[model samples]
Target: MTRSVRRTRRILQVTGVSAAALLALSACSSSDSDSSASASASGKLSGDVTVFAAASLKESFTTLGKEFEKQHPGTKVTFSFGGSDSLAASITGGAPADVFASASPKTMKIVTDAKDNATEPATFVRNQLEIATLPGNPDKVASLKDLTNSDLKVVLCDRTVPCGAAAQKALDASKLKLTPVSYEEDVKSALNKVVLKEADAAVVYKTDVKAAGEKVEGVEFPESADAVNDYPITLLKESKNPETAKAFMALVQSAEGQKVLNESGFLNP
Candidate 1:
């Protein structure tokens, strides 16, 4: 048979009896369902599940998104990754998304306070800050204080971003005031500066450094302990695909999901 003929047959099959069965199964997991939330764990998932997430979660969330699609063949996982604060703003401004995974509770509050979440946010994982330096540690930087040197061109996430907030908390705890050459909008942007050799170092999440691999070197600082960020996930109130969104959220908080995140260098919540 020709390719178009095969494609038409596939479309017809999807809209047949199988589609009705899926819709029936999906109702069991819908936010309005009287069924327990756990029903979503085993129910059929379909349609598009759009997620707005923190930039720090890009790698791990992408891994989970692929797995979500694998688990439910007809479902698609689309993501909008950026600074947590900016993402929250978009959601509250009526951007359509099924789920929201924020890098910090403070940013999540923006959505929750606006009553934009269908469910209470849950802390799924935590992340800590690390100094991302150019490969070979060209500056021989040893601690967070090392970045304070006026000679080093350092980058940091903007203060409104989660990673930036955590870095500031760490700095305050250490009583150090390090000025960065630039403040990028998100953690990835900050790390990109170091990776592209635009800056000597940047303060970013440990996961980001691990994701960068050979592109940048990670330096651990004791103050990071004082600034660990809690990552939260929630189902959006405006989600058009509640069943699939709940299933995706369940997968994110599942054991298998935790394994993917842990492997990416995120700490347990």
Candidate 2:
């Protein structure tokens, strides 16, 4: 071969080898990216997520948590359900929970204000106060005013909790004065009083009454319209499993989650 031809061939072979090497590296990078994306798309979530939620969310959230665990096989969801204010306190006090779902924005503010939330809180549900009474509503409590009867043993939630705050608002709107026999710290506690026949009536969320089942009868009062508690939820800043926590939050806002809440008597946010 001519010297020029030999030189040109050598140059071409070198260029060809370099191109092959470049192509192989590009292919490997693309493969890695595709694998990462595929893993993400498969929704492979695995972790133990702790959720602090409102007392009234017990039944519905429990159902949703089971569904979440089913969808994310290796994932576990543990819950702490109580008054919204108390839950907020725990979160603000450095409780290592993955998510926080409050019954009212006011209580959620406690966490958001303390910068304990990872994202801006979103309202997930709204609830209104209802009169929970003995089975069949033995006292015939039809409206908010009926609870004002001095003879009836009525229990109210502590003013600090979402349910209690809502109850107070409803009473203020109705311009009625009531002296409850006892003020419970949470809606569930107030509802339990009626369920146990310790109190004749208690003002609690409609969802709570439904959760109580045959133990108590619910009375819809117009005054409840004045006070609707907006439940807010968010991933906490201290969440050890942020990705799993976010997935759970998304599930709670999904259609399936809403269905469970609706079935439990909670209104849509």
Candidate 3:
């Protein structure tokens, strides 16, 4: 073979090898970019996030949970809703939970004081007390004083719960001494009593009355202004899915989440 021919072949060989290397590198780069894009698009949250939330949050939080699942495919959110104090007790007792959302800062303090929270609790919403009465206000209840009627069988949340505490604060503020027919464990139970016609009226959260819809009539008493409850939410330290839990917390504080809460009659924090 001629020297020039040999030189040309050598150059062609080198070029071919270089072209193959370049193509391989390009393919790898493309693959990596695709993988990253897919991951970003799919969102990083997965697994289940168990949330311990207040009873009043059942309706709003459930809605947010569904939305969170929709935004993060393959992720599930399970909620345990009850009195803030009771939920706090459960979380502090080493219950397995990804997040804790309380209807009052007082209850949230239990988790924070126990060092069970991964982060400082953030207040997401506020709620006030309302008297939930039978539909059409058949009892002719108009104010807090009306609930004190001897003939009325009024129910209230247990003093340990956020709703009951708020109700007590409102009553204290009004300087009214009234005995409730029963003190239920949570706001929902207190509201349920009125809805089921087991009680003439129930002092519950305004959100609870709203959730009850036509089943109960909400009577807003001015005294409730003094006992507004601030709802706080935090990621738990023992979360099995911390990333997903934090993402869920962010979703709850997001504008979209606030919209859901507002529609459910919760006041902005």
Q: Which residue pairs does candidate 2 place in steric collision?
A: none
lDDT of 2 by residue, 54-94 (tens): 99999999999999999989999999999888888888888
lDDT of each: 0.92, 0.92, 0.91
| Best candidate, lDDT | 1
Candidate 3 — what's its lDDT? 0.91
Query: Which scores higher on lDDT, 1 or 2?
Result: 1
**TM per candidate:** 0.84, 0.85, 0.85
Query: Which residue pairs clash in candidate 3?
Result: none
Error of 1 at 81 (Å): 0.2
lDDT of 1 at 259: 96
lDDT for each residue of candidate 1 in 1-269, tens digit (9 for 90 to 100): 99999999989988897889888788756845655655666666779989999999999999999999998999999999999999999998889998999999999999999964557999999999999999999899999999899999999999999999999999999999988999999999999998889999999999999999999999999999999999999998888999889999989899999999999999999
* Candidate 1 segments whose C-alpha is farther than 4 A from its true place: 1-42
Please state the error at residue 113 of candidate 3 in Å. Answer: 0.4
Model 2 worst lDDT window (10 residues): 110-119
**Model 3, stretches more than 4 Å misplaced?**
1-43
Between prediction 1 and prediction 3, the one with superior TM-score is: 3
